[model samples]
Target: MSINSVKGAAIVTGAAQGIGKAIAIRLAKDGYDMALNDVPGKEDLLHTLADEIISQGRKSTIIIADVTNEKSVVEMIKRTVSELGILRVMVANAGIALTIGTEFLDTRLEDFEKVLKVNLMGVFLCYREAARQMVQQGTWGRASSVNGKRESHRDEHLIFFKEKKNNHYRAAAEMKKYGITVNAYAPGYIDTPMARQALSVNENLSNEEIRQQIIQRGSSSSGLAVNLGTPEDIANFVSYLASEESKFMTGQAVSVNGGVFFG
Candidate 1:
């Protein structure tokens, strides 16, 4: 197959780093062209990722847009279909952890709203725009959201996560007739830049300390995997979900959290 040859095209939000970056790269390797999305100021990272994907024999484009904005999301989908081919996958992975360590009473209203705005509303917009494009194109596609599940220890952001999961169910139902499947990937403590940032908040922890903290958290559960999961762990599952193998899966949030929260 030529470098431009592709199974389809996928748009992964928050593709600049962490799980989103992993998913984008994996999808590209899976033979799908990639449209990488991230907020402004992450152009360097996105550009570098796009180049890497192109180097791997797949077409790639960088789309800088804020998922929280409806117009931006629409434009992103439009540009993606315009640049790449039909949209086969939409990974709504852009999110923030502003209230990660804050208690419910200590969390400010602005912080809570910011979290919802990015994590909840962002996923909703991506799902809406992507579903619209898929329905119009009459293509079988997959849409998945990250951080859509709440962990027991992360109860402060319960509403945000719950809302994201709800969006998945609703989107899956509405898009089912159009041959589009919407799902959510609930990751436990994946080793990612975001996780490190969240863990290091107001703490004097080194990189190794953070890694050990994540390992301890995952080990607390009697899961099959006792170590912290890498971003590729979630991305590999996403690859399966985005493929024809998961045609029967929809309206569900699968847990990739190392058995931390079993379904």
Candidate 2:
């Protein structure tokens, strides 16, 4: 849907900064009320955003949550809805990752599990809870709504890259019955705080030398103008997907990485 068409409150997780913050603020400017979420110390960052939301005269509630924690996620959604009224959009944007140096055989088993838990499993739990709430809201939202699907219809075919695919897709399938579309946007080369940290720490190259590598990659691909994309560039595309305009689309893993990982 067009920006003007997206109304009501949206819950943007990991929103104290980066693409999450960009999405939250962009929605506020579009007249959608907001429910923000971040880790504990990021309260101050959200406070600044809450002020910006209020300055635009939209409603807001800031919540601290860890998406990987099921208990924390459930409580976060419950409080956000109770305080903000309804949840139209759930971003599932919170993720934890690292560019660990350990080789495959040398890596601790915990490293792989931790990454899978937070990045993959966390998104599953958030979608499960948010879809339940958002689906109920979606019914109240429009006309000719269908009832929840039969249990057998919940199956969704998904690609398996590393034995983690079906797990997340199963959660997404549950989300479909509620008219709440769920999808993941796999970002590539958009400069966030996390990527910059990894880039700066490269022992094999100077910071400027590493920066040039990133620039050359993006600029050489798909007509990238500046050679590096800002978080807002990713946020803009995500904003469209989260809106009602993308009703016919769901369960996609879109890559915004210039020309990376093409089939």
TM-score against native, each model: 0.90, 0.77
Question: Each prediction's Cα lDDT score?
Answer: 0.81, 0.63
What are the per-residue Cα lDDT tens digits for candidate 2 across 51-119? 998777788899898878999999988988898777777776775544523334554667657766666
Error of 1 at 127 (Å): 0.3
Off by over 4 Å in 2: 1-6, 100-102, 138-164, 200-210, 213-227
Please estimate how well model 2 matches the true structure, expressed as its whole-model Cα lDDT: 0.63
Model 1: worst 10 consecutive residues (lDDT sum): 218-227
